[model samples]
Target: MKPVSELLKKRAAAVRSVAPESTVFDALHLLAEYDVGALVVMQDGKLQGIFSERDYTRKIALQGRDSRHTTVREVMTPSVLVVRPDSDVRECMSLMSQRKIRHLPVVDGDRVTGMISIRDLMDDIIADDEMTIAQLQSYIYG
Candidate 1:
């Protein structure tokens, strides 16, 4: 099984983040601009939590809270599920499925490295399957 570090190398290494004290509205704008479903909540160069569109909808809009006044920390998921660089991709998939979460932060020690989504894993799996099928076809025809 491939490790998350390999997957991280295949894509951009930058992990977008916002300060915990930032307003939900600001975080929303960052999400829109990045076209991502979630953003890592950072405070003092540390991973504080995770803020996603779901948090905004469920915690802010549903609660009738003002996005401009509400802090990202207030609506963010405080207890985030994180993965390590050496973690297997399959394990990450299982965790996401069991937890019903869409995103995970890749951490190496205390530093946040990258972020991966369900879509990323699914795409990688599909690609690997395709490669295997192609190799099988080549061997059969040889």
Candidate 2:
């Protein structure tokens, strides 16, 4: 039952972000450049919202809005779901599943420390399962 802090330690510390006032096209560019599906929308060094590919497709493209002219704040998910460093990984996974969300910002106090995706949680779970199986095998053989 590893906490999310352990997972964050294993990942790159840099959290890719964009300003709320930034154009959707610019945010999309950042997303492509970072090779990520989402970007944290920040304002005054605080978490404002989250901009994701799903937001782009449903809010911008589907609405026939111009990405070059539309602001990220206009399409970003403003009501973000956040977690803390000490939060359990399993709990985060359950929240993501129930909410049908892919990304969650890891906030400690007022600062955003990192972001975790469903993929990250799933990978950790798989690794944990493998380790448990190996330990069981070793104990049985010994």
Candidate 3:
């Protein structure tokens, strides 16, 4: 099984984040520019919450709130589900599934190290499975 720490290390460890006081419009801009679905909300270098496209759609758009004027703290998901860098990808997947969350922030001690998305986990799993199958085939033939 691939550990989240390995996956994060192989991929970029950079995680996009915004201040809690930042406007939702700013978060949206970051999300679009980074081609990411979510942003970690930080306050003084501490993880505050998470803001995602889902929050915008369900909390802002549904309520007809102005993204430009509203702060991310107003619409962000404040529960802030997090996982350790050494955690297994399967555990992360299960936590996300149970919470119905798409993104999880990875922490190393008290510091935010990286972030993982459901799509990222899925892609890794698919690639790993393919590699395993290929190795098995080679073993049988050789």
Candidate 4:
């Protein structure tokens, strides 16, 4: 399995983020703009929490809280499960599966590098398998 650092390199150049004090409405807009399911909640270059669609739906929509007024800090998922850049991709997948979560923030010491979804891991695994199959076919037939 590749390290999380390799996956990070393949990700977008910017890691979209918002401050804890940002309104849920604004966070939602950022999510839409970035075409992502979640945004990292950061303040002073540190990861505070993660604000996601799940957080919005369960905490604001279901709870009848106004997104325009309510702060992301009110609904954001805290104590986020983070993985170091050197962490194995498969291990991160297992962690997300067992925890029933979709996103994992890649951290190196005190800095947040990037985030990865289960979809990213699955795509990487599938690509690796396809390459192996191609190599096997070449050896067998050529």
Per-model CA lDDT versus the true structure = 0.95, 0.96, 0.90, 0.92
Q: lDDT by residue for model 2 over 1-142, one digit each (tens)?
A: 7889999999899989999999999999999999999999999999999999999999999999999999999999999999999999999999999999999999999999999999999999999999999999999998
Task: Spell out the clash pairs found in candidate 4.
Answer: none
Better of 2 and 3 by lDDT: 2
Error of 4 at 105 (Å): 0.6
lDDT of 1: 0.95
**TM-score for all models, in order of appearance:** 0.97, 0.97, 0.95, 0.96
Q: In model 3, which runs have C-alpha deviations exceeding 4 angstroms? A: none
Residue 98 lDDT (model 2): 99
In angstroms, what RMSD does candidate 1 have relative to the true structure?
0.9
Q: Please, what are the lDDT tens digits per residue for candidate 4 over residues 16-116?
A: 89999999999999999998898899999999999999999999999999999999999999889999999998999899999999999988899888999
Per residue, candidate 3 scores C-alpha lDDT tens digits across 1-142 of 6689888878765779988899999899999999999999988889999999999999999999999999999889898989998889988888999999999999888899999999989888889899999999999998
The weakest ten consecutive residues by lDDT in model 3 span 6-15
Q: List the residue pairs that clash in candidate 2.
A: none
Q: Any idea what lDDT model 2 has?
A: 0.96
Please report the candidate that would top lDDT against the real structure: 2
Order of models, best lDDT first: 2, 1, 4, 3
Residue 116 lDDT (model 2): 94
